[model samples]
Target: MKANGPFKILALLFVTVLAFYLIAYHTIEGRRNRNGPWIVAFTNDLSGAPALRIDHPALAITNVQLVFPDAMLPTNFTAKTILFQRPRPVPFPLPMGECIFMDTTFLPGSVVMRMSGHEVQLIPRVLTINGREQPWKSGETIALTAILTNAISPRLNGR
Candidate 1:
């Protein structure tokens, strides 16, 4: 019993230190939770040039994603930028025929596209059109700058 006393004390000390480290450095994350400061997304229902309409154009975008059909591939190109001074109507490229995912905090929720095997989902907390605030919804589609003509095979679009 006496020999086990020191071992128990050391175990307790190690556990205490681990608990402190966990509390200090660990962050809790969950579904529909913002991963960082801001997120941007777009819907799939739009009839305009590829343009991003952010409700508050002040938050510097840390990440950007472009979804488009290139070379018969549903390519999702992503880019991460160092924090910078945000300018209104920020000069981020929105390749036409691509789409944005409107998750304003983090990128979660996905559309398991059977044909492509992957797609993005956005939960828009804020929405804007022509620089005016508007009520967005569960899912919306915003067109990008370029247009996709016969990009998807007829069978893919359910022909």
Candidate 2:
């Protein structure tokens, strides 16, 4: 039996086209997950310090991972000195600030003294913006006063 030359050429062409198509498809669809950091300004103040209450019509932060500076007081110490209070767990997106309060007792956990123990507080506290995987932006400086009001986490309690 004799083979055909045109058939071989056609076969090679088909392979070449298939390779190119695969490469282009992978490039377009294989983009990995990418997300940017979160940065926001404290538009108002509560009591005396600038804080975000999260009380307006119930604003909820989902998957909030607070990234404080390494120099900030340890989590255990803060729990011991600071008194953390939160609103009754009613539902998602509860009130922001007014419902929660940090009593000045310093009864057992005093995050204030432990935090103030250090001479200086680091600027531009990095927090997850919109549950994204990027750190917040400072832009030359901490653009606004960001009081880490509600850090909803199960691992570390107290504030």
Candidate 1 local lDDT, 1-159, one digit each (tens)? 999999999999999999988876554443224333233433222332222222223333222333333223214633222211122232233322223322233333211111122232322343343234445432343332333346678889887
lDDT per prediction? 0.35, 0.28
Consecutive 10-residue window with the lowest summed lDDT within model 1: 109-118
lDDT of 2 by residue, 1-159 (tens): 247788888999999999999998776544321111112222222222322211111112222212222223223331211112222332222112121212212211111111111111111232322222244332222113234445568657753
Candidate 1: segments with Cα more than 4 A from true spot: 27-35, 43-47, 55-159
Clashes of each: 16, 14
Q: What is the C-alpha RMSD of each candidate to the true structure, in Å?
A: 14.5, 18.0
Once fitted onto the true fold, the runs of candidate 2 whose alpha carbons sit more than 4 angstroms away are 1-3, 32-159
TM-score of 1: 0.30
TM-scores for the candidates: 0.30, 0.22
Instruction: Name the best candidate (by TM-score).
Output: 1
